[model samples]
Target: MKFASLDPASVSPRRSRRLWPWLLLSPLLLIAIAATLAVQSRPLVEPVDGGLKPEEIQSTKDFLRRNDPRRLQASPHRLLRIEERQLNLMLMQLAQRYGQGRGAAQIQLQAGTARLQASLQMPALGVWLNLEARLSQTLALPQVEELRLGHLPLPAWLAEAALRRGLGHLALSVQAQRAGELVESLRFNPQELLLGYHWQADSLDHVLGAFWTPDEQERAQAYNRRLVEISAAYPPGSSVSLALLMPPIFELARARSERPDADPVAENRAALLTLALFSTGQRWSKLLPSARAWPQPLPRMVTLAGRDDFPQHFLVSAVLALEGSGPLADAIGVYKEVADSRGGSGFSFNDIAADRAGTRFGLLAKDAPRSLQALMRVGLHELDFMPGVADLPEFLSAEAFQQRYGGIDAPAYRQMMAEIEARIAALPLLQQANVPRL
Candidate 1:
């Protein structure tokens, strides 16, 4: 877990600000809380059947393979196959995450129907809320045959309505709903399930906007717009280095930081987001649709170590870490390189190095924003954050990749990864105070 230091001066005032909202909404809040308590008053199903078994968990490589980045640009329709064991393991992982180690989830698939069951522990009330949803036919076009909350079976529509209402208050529900709409097909078998989806980019900015205030959104947009201007100054098709933009952008952040009541972390996050996206050849409109009206970012071959692909791997992973989790970003990075080995550019450890660098930089910007700001106030050299690409292996075919390094869990792969990690740790940028090696 992580923690934030509390400010004594702000505690009372923050509590004071919070009182009005709670007081005004007390009636609705109480009603909702009461309804929830009534529905989950007792355990309808056995709670915590089999604890999460480490032996039953899927291999980490299998987990990593799910984040393949090639899916981002693949055809609209795609299929994913999972067996019963994998599904249950995935559920166990999810329950551990959302159920705070006190819950369990299991799915039993057979014939044309599936049964999904879950039990969650209520805080301070020691009660287990059990639910089971029965679905017939396809998960893509889901048909809810039965819905049970605790021991009470309810009409499908009633449960659907209740769920819709409950989902409105969840912070990530919008993203989840948007993502679910992309499912294209589903087939359930006695032993396995086949799930297919359309690959469409969901605007993460829109998803994250749920947490940002209007002012924060506008501030991020301003940085994106500045990047457009920065791109315009360079010639199209020529090489553009992120070095050209980082210092200037962070200087803007520093200026904003000097203003009263400004949050240095948020400022630094916005600047990093802008730089990473623009340097990667991505359209700003993808970040925010209003960016469509902004000047076009001129085309340039963003290069590091004289290779155009390095920038894409680096900046993309950086921004992923900035907005998401570091482990997730790292796994996705590996997936990209693995996908490349399959008849694309082949695998390249150099690119992996770049991806690692980006992840660390993103983490630094996220966890040590004030320290990042102080460094940016001075200047940035390419070598500080992204040092020289070592003489690592590159451009190996799939067969060669497997023969030489085996899989990601192989000792050879891990040794090379360790070398890459050490290189990143030695960078002058990460060497600075408060900067961490991811």
Candidate 2:
């Protein structure tokens, strides 16, 4: 059979017209394509080494605590020093907190300037927004010398204009103004930045308080006070079952939720924060310096299944899971255990199980914050979130871990992991979170 061919006379004029429109659109279309290609599908910046380390977190807290204008006065001659790593750590914390755990930041200092590079994922488009900025000092005040977005290098004048525009926008925000008043100067070194600040009374408070809202602060303080009350009878240095402590705070959350204006998510978040802080043997004052003056939380070793380490692993990981992602929470838990195996207390699958349980609890908290608060109001037990851990291996040194389980990719290690996942899957409380099988 022969194929039929269209005659010139039979061709539609509409098709010809569409071809002309494409010519008209070619320039824009090409530019759009280029931009899309330039913006990477994967994040460009390398993550800070040892993602969210404890010492870095403590450094962040200590920095805030020392410079808290409400509590301490700054000296005119003294300049506060912060490491490049600390700045990056704070950036990572902000990324995890607000970026859905989808960004990384790195600062490379050179003499008097810093090369700040960061990347953030725009999930809706599945593209990363890469940013690079050259920061310099002008009369001890921080200033931007250049800025680049994605693959496009903005002109120096345009960067200056953008910086001016940014400063103007920041001026409109009262919180920014308060924060700005505290920045007197910035001098940079290869590895650190020196900051000079005026003694602006309450400036730090105003700035930090804007983030830690008064309403949220009340929720946090209320939980902390109630927890203090619960810890009082246990004696200062004695151990308390996390089981015994969870009920009263969550019951308070439920009671609060009955009110028409109660925010269940916020309630649960506050409760988790309070409990995690207590379980980890930390105080709310770590973040909010003013809280240092609040009623002291009684010293108590909170335990899960009579093991103190379990509560720290569980509750803190739960908090991370609530704020970040399950994978991040899980990775952090594993990282801690692996780190321990190297030299610390030795690797413990028992603690890993607790971490997995806490992660599930946190995942559920994220999925249905109110439902979790409502469900946990009555009672909590080890069996509710965690399965039996005594049979699991613990206190294994790196050599021992290698000798027995091989490694994480090995069959033995994977079998143990599957067992842990199976145990977590069986938890009714975690089941309510609609956890996806890992």
Candidate 3:
């Protein structure tokens, strides 16, 4: 009989931080745990029945084929489609690779419960931990209330405590809700977990394009209010990268905009614009050299009363980082230093945040030509290629540069950005490249 080994005491603090999030995010892991714990004291019978249906076999195969990134090898068949004896053997092989000893595990669907049976190995205790868990479909989180280790039953208090702790760590409300919905849609038989998720073709565009819903409308406004409160939290010379992921409210706004029958409120529409700007700016920042200079995006708690805005302030302070003795670095550094010197006030950057606050629906971006040129110099350092000064004469013309890459009004702008990002991704790291041009 195969046994899965688990030694919780060996988990280090650093590993715990990384592993807990991954484990807690996946409901499948929870089910696997429940299935492992529940198989205790259950009779081990030969495979009498329980194999995935033909259609389920096809869908599972298709899911793996699409999701697996490895192109050089042929995709393997789903485990649930195979015989129990073969499945356990495969699990044993996987267990060895993952530092877990082989474990005998099986799932069966009966009387509206997805039951999992397993003989787990507790290496620390040197004991066989047998478990049987019954997973029932409920509106809230699925409970693995019934659990046993060997002939002894696990305390309900212990299981509930663990469940509460696991769920508490998932802070993304929107993602958690989606995960719950995914669990709810699962159809399980002893053989397999049937995913009834209908893939939406437009979902990616709807998210990236800044969609919003009524609830999201409120959230977007809240985001701006938060921005107003926290914009001054850092000092005049300190600046941070706008690294925050697009919030759910923006996605809702995009959906609202696409619907012919629905009209989005002014607040959400404004939020959508701000988020889109923020997302685009953050993306463009990556096309340049120094990525770590972009700190983790400020949290919603600080910016939005839990409602957050896309940052509009060009990071004048960060441009100072480009200064160094190297010819390319010094050129950019001197440009930014000179520009900041000309501004007189320590706060040389424009305060466009307030423009977003009241009824006015707009923001003023600080115009720092020297800072822009400095950043381009950094980008050039990353390339082995130098577009000869004669090949791109507009590189010297300020008006030409602005006309070519300044406006973000047209859909073609997005295509251009995509191309720029692709080109950036193809280049080597700045430090790795030996080009001597500034």
Candidate 4:
């Protein structure tokens, strides 16, 4: 029952050998610790000077600054005046050929000088052109209607001549009108149109000859060709024809005629830069898929009061909205009511219904799949997605409208909704809420 006392000398050799192993391992552990300390103590490299030097950085900045769209300003006044002169010349000849009594019918020429004043400050050249075109359209209606109706019974050759002259006049008139509106809407004013007329003799000559000289024609044609090229380059719903036409016309008119700093190449380059920037800004939402997923809520719902003539009228109240507010909400309500009143026919919310609340829907509603295909085609070819329900509300025919709006054929709504969902899934977590749930 007595406790046994153990002596250090009697310990087993195996146990003593284990202690030796620990002693031996101490140096290795110390070495590992030393290595870690050495590693941690080492100085971190300054991120290998990846950035440019101050001077180089500044030089690049300077290059970008020099090439900025804002720096490429041309006198909108001069451009407008030139446009006006060209338009007047074309109109006079049209009146001579197509007026009711040959040149006897009074030819009235009015330019939207006020509108042109506003165009001077437009940030984008394309918008300016649209404004000009709108102005011209308003002005040419009277002359165009006169020629079209009056010249109907003339001989074929003479009729053709009249038609061409009338068309030219109408084109110029519309272009000028649109330009003026665009300038006014954007609130741009360059005050360049107020200068002394260096091209006074040229203006007189243009008025005398209904057509541009070959040289002038070539310049205008080249500009138009560029516009065609640009329009073709963008995807469906991404280009505006009027926008493409403005910059070059401005540059060409300024270059061809005597003007200060008559550098055509520089002017052209500048015009191109301005156009690109403006177009990018305007179509940025359409061009970038990421942009579409962001939902902007409208402040309030819109309601349009019923009108006797326009039972189905609607308008775009906001360019991009999360919730409708002000006029936009009212517009949306009007559009929805129009759509709902049709009772499933192919007519859009903008189309007039035979009955105020009829049950007759269009072909598109009958065959959604077919309608979607037609709508896609319309989106691709006609409106280019830039047009809302308000613009070009009618299609090729009522049938076409039925097919486009109500058909809903290819890429079925469900499929499109799914795709949109997938796209939303891929977005950053914060942006997911913006995607509309179908």
| lDDT, each prediction | 0.72, 0.77, 0.36, 0.31
TM-score of candidate 1 versus the correct structure, residues matched by position: 0.61
lDDT score, residue 305, model 4? 25
In the range 1-438, model 3's lDDT, one tens digit per residue, is 999786888878898899887877799886677655544433332221222222333344454565532432332221223333444444432222222222456666543466656654555555455655667755434457576555556675576664455345432344444434433244444554443332244332333223334455444445444443444465554443332322333344445445665434443434434444343334212322222233333432212211122133222212211111122111222233223333432111112111111111111111222222222332233122110111212112333323554423346534543443333333342223322212
lDDT of 2 by residue, 216-242 (tens): 788889899998898887866788888
Model 4 Cα lDDT, one tens digit per residue, 174-262: 34433333232211123212212123323323332333334433443444344445455556544244223333434343444345534
lDDT (Cα, 0-100) at 37 in candidate 4: 36
Whichever of 1 and 2 has more lDDT, that candidate is: 2
* TM-score of each model, in listed order: 0.61, 0.71, 0.26, 0.16
* Candidate that scores best on TM-score: 2
- What ranking emerges by lDDT with the best candidate at the front? 2, 1, 3, 4
TM-score ranking from best candidate downward: 2, 1, 3, 4
What is the lDDT for 176 in model 1? 62
Q: Which ten residues in a row have the lowest lDDT in candidate 4?
A: 354-363
Model 2, poorest ten-residue lDDT window?
A: 166-175
Give candidate 1 regions above 4 Å deviation: 1-170, 174-216, 257-265, 377-379
TM-score comparison, 1 vs 3, better candidate? 1
